[model samples]
Target: MGYVMQPSRPIDWIRNAIRYTRHSPKRLDVFKKCVKAEKIDSKALLCLDIPTRWNSTYKMLDRAQKIEKAFNAFDLAHPNYRNNLRDGVPKVTDWSYARKLRNLLELFKHKTNNASATKYVTVNMFYIEMMDIYTHIRNMKGIDPESRLMADAMQNKFDKYWGTNNKGLNYILYFAAILDPQSKLGVLSFGFACVFKAEKKERDQRGT
Candidate 1:
């Protein structure tokens, strides 16, 4: 996989754009008015992302995408829209990248929500969920070079945690998965074989 040493451009752009918009009452008002005019859901407000939380970034992008048309109109109606912003305003390409980022982050969002469910025991499911995350990060093919760079940066972090010496492949996780009736040893065996590229016999021996 490709390596990117810089910060994720799409995320940085979104963070700056949101901060810039929130700082300007006139721009924010125009955004709200446009949302109302467009008959978008009232909850579809442009939310600012918390620097610490990935899910909040997902929410910010999702909301921003919903109001993209409004931003487009605002840019056309106000010639000074871009100039007035403290940071550079988001362009159409930035908005498109946000949509792509949102889609990719949705998988993590859903996994996080599921893990947070209080009613069910989620321990056995964690192994599968983490594997899914690893697979998703590894398989990502971004829409453009910038998006690809962002994905590569994320993948690098994921690899640090899960790859190299297969540190993430703990026996406890497999044991927990095997103990769950819904996903027994057979499932664990198959999963190990696929992820580690181990032979079926080796996977079965490991499971045993």
Candidate 2:
């Protein structure tokens, strides 16, 4: 949303924190002491993120958050943790935003990974993947301000191709879905119900 940072405070502060801690052996040692004092147990230490990939950022935050107490401690123990950053130190709310974004990104990373898998791509998978995303977006619309904005942006892009208002429905996707035992007519019916209400379809199915 706001560059790679989502809301700017979440990812940007996170990026700075990791780079700050690991930039020098001395600084990292101080952070480790903070970690130890807090009794933090982690298999992985704080890691930097690449600006291009959300998953990398997610990993960075996922690791950082496990030792959130350490980070808070480091902020106090190391003066530069505040003085070095242009944006000041990470706060409770910053971590809260990070926590929410981290949770959201985890599911998205999983979806993108599944969709991006090249080992075996199938026609039926197309609809299922898209449907999952569409449903996810719809559900996320009212959850939080950031999520609503993100979901709305995504929904806009999604609608251009797959919206019911679009005249050219891709029947091949339907055919593929119908053939898949895991996702057959029910998925299509659900898709139709999303565009057009389920009540009508339910009545039609019942022939009543």
Candidate 3:
């Protein structure tokens, strides 16, 4: 007979929610919108009859409850795998990475009126697409006949596109454009310059 290990439970999600909001009210607001987003429901409402502070407090708690439930399922299946930061290095699992990407996309999509979301969506979509191509190349790296086909496919995808350039430095510029849309696409480019550069470096080394 094989020994069975009971699944590890994550810290209570609702409790963590309270902690997060208590630490930063603004974060609570941001996550409320994100929760509404994943549920595809109507946006939270504000009533003229209610005090603004009380309204926000209620909404924040309500959102915390919902988010707590939503994450419980995801966490159970994925186990919240994280690296030991004390080791001065970090590692991530595909499940967590996939969830991160999805959550960011949801956040961007929910910010319907924010130009930053549009810009980020475009840049991140591009980066994820590029990663897909890079992943294929990596998977085929050591195989002879199979490698040629994958390389050809990657070349076609990279050479045939025409937005933001393949240099990938534009991802930072895109994020900057999000923060400062008034610049005509140049003002805050430097702000995210480091972000794109580091992402580019990391992109090159990521495994399939």
Candidate 4:
């Protein structure tokens, strides 16, 4: 579960690298003015991520990516900027990775927001969302070698929580899917057939 435990490492490093710029009032004001000049529809200040919240991290990276050029400009124009950030600033690759990671995390952010909605019952969404997350992890695994590592870690955690043998794999999730009007027993049967290659009787027994 390296990925699950450390998904924010890179973002944390980037944040640390730019901590001075983010905290410096002079640099922040200059960065804000530069963003205004460019007419970029972004906040006037950089967002520091809250450690406990993933969505806040996403928002921080998203805003940082948008104002990357402004940060560069500020760095170049401000005297003693390099001295202030002695630990080294984020490079182009770091920013690029942040952008990619932000995109990758968008699905989770959206799902989290949707699940928190108060207007409707969210139980029906559990099955589909879990499947969607599973597929997304698989896709990430196939994307590239680096992503493969992250995906592998995530997959390990996913299986730990939802694998056939895991206690977290309750029958209610399957029953919920079967109860959905759009995807009834047909979808459930197909899914079970794929997951459990045993006889129909065995699968039914497990379900019951």
Candidate 5:
């Protein structure tokens, strides 16, 4: 739910494809044939994403990506599937974006689980997990235009809550990291430099 997902046609197609196949038994049988036609041996099948559930979206997209070929095959075999969907069938590029989006969200799902765990002292892990997500967004930005758009949107939301200028942050995460001894000030300073973009300047004429 933290993700600031831009409304997208690719996701809409994914949603519609799952609904198209799963809603009707006839469609499901035909989709199974198409799945077999594609030699997709996985037991998992496409399911719908719930808007409010973060993991559900990941499950939906991840499963859809694994069986994408069957969806493509279904598009070709069933003529009504196209006419029924307002967005029509997804093109090759649409699937490509969907793949990228799934990859992007995959990490978030894992980290979300880690943060939500109740049996451990999670505070010490906060700075590292948040920073990893920050790094991932930076890495994802240069993949392509569509990726940049997605990354940029997410970055904005990230900045809103966790940016250098934001005051709502819990400072205890820094203390927890410091108290760990393995991290201490070095990890804290590194995080500050990265988040604040405040690189160390050389004392002499040359830069550090």
Candidate 6:
């Protein structure tokens, strides 16, 4: 019984932080500043059957399943809670994640790379989980020094990893996603000089 109580305080704190952060002006500013506009190539992503992305296929499935379960728990905990929700909510069960997990488990059992639809589903599941965590942190409130420090650290990491003009994680993923499978020269890398130009073009096109 005492063991059960251990998680309550932290969970409640996280929940309250999540709720309050969803409405903060700082959070909104961060969202507008950090959320990048890019295309996701689900079909192409499915083609890359890289097992190194995860320790093992079974591990990948297990992690993805846990993520799915976490999402489900959060969903049931807060129905109609769209304050910080996105396309990644409800963490669909028996879907891509599950299929990939099952495929991965099979792969581990058989040691085969012929898993046709395994790659994209697992990758998408990861992307979704990361997006949710990032969004949650972006919208979270920091009332204490520790929380504020943690928030700042997370924000800085996001900015460092994904907030570059040309060589950012976003740019890498975008280029990779849109790569021509047959072409070695068609894929373009964004230069710092062109990043602003592309951003402006995107904004103008979006009428934002």
lDDT of each: 0.69, 0.76, 0.36, 0.70, 0.80, 0.37
Q: Give the true-structure RMSD of model 5.
A: 4.8
Per-residue lDDT for 1-208 in model 6, tens only?
0001112233233233334324556653332232221121121101111333322434434433333333344344444434555443433433453444344234223322322246553322322233444454444323445344444555555445544432635444444433534322232333333444644764697799
Top TM-score model:
5
Q: What TM-score against the true fold does each predicted structure earn?
A: 0.75, 0.75, 0.21, 0.78, 0.82, 0.25
Per-residue alpha-carbon lDDT of candidate 3 for residues 42-140, written as tens digits (9 for 90 to 100): 454321111222223334334433344333332323232112112211123322332332332232233322333544444423333343444444444
Q: Give the TM-score of candidate 2.
A: 0.75
Give candidate 4 regions above 4 Å deviation. 1-13, 50-53, 192-208
Better of 1 and 4 by lDDT: 4
Segments in model 1 whose C-alpha atoms lie over 4 Å from true places? 1-11, 24-26, 76-80, 141-148, 164-171, 198-208
Clashes within 3 Å, all models in order: 0, 0, 0, 0, 0, 1
Q: For residue 26, give model 1's deviation from the true position in Å.
A: 4.7
Model 4 lDDT-worst window of ten: 1-10
Candidate 5: deviation at residue 173, Å?
2.3
Name the weakest run of 10 consecutive residues (lDDT summed) in model 3. Answer: 1-10
Query: How would you encode candidate 1's per-residue C-alpha lDDT over 122-191 as one tens digit per residue?
Result: 8899778977876776567335676566566776666565554555556776678889998898887677
The lowest-lDDT stretch of 10 consecutive residues in candidate 1 is: 1-10
Error of 5 at 47 (Å): 1.9
Model 4: per-residue Cα lDDT at residue 125: 76
Candidate 3 vs 6: which has more lDDT: 6
Best lDDT among the predictions, by candidate number = 5
Model 2 Cα lDDT, one tens digit per residue, 49-160 = 7755667878888898888899889988998788888565777888888888788668667777786788986677877777776777777767978788876666666677
What tens digits encode model 4's per-residue C-alpha lDDT throughout 68-166? 777677667775666666545677877888898788777768877877889998777776777677777767866777777867677777778766668
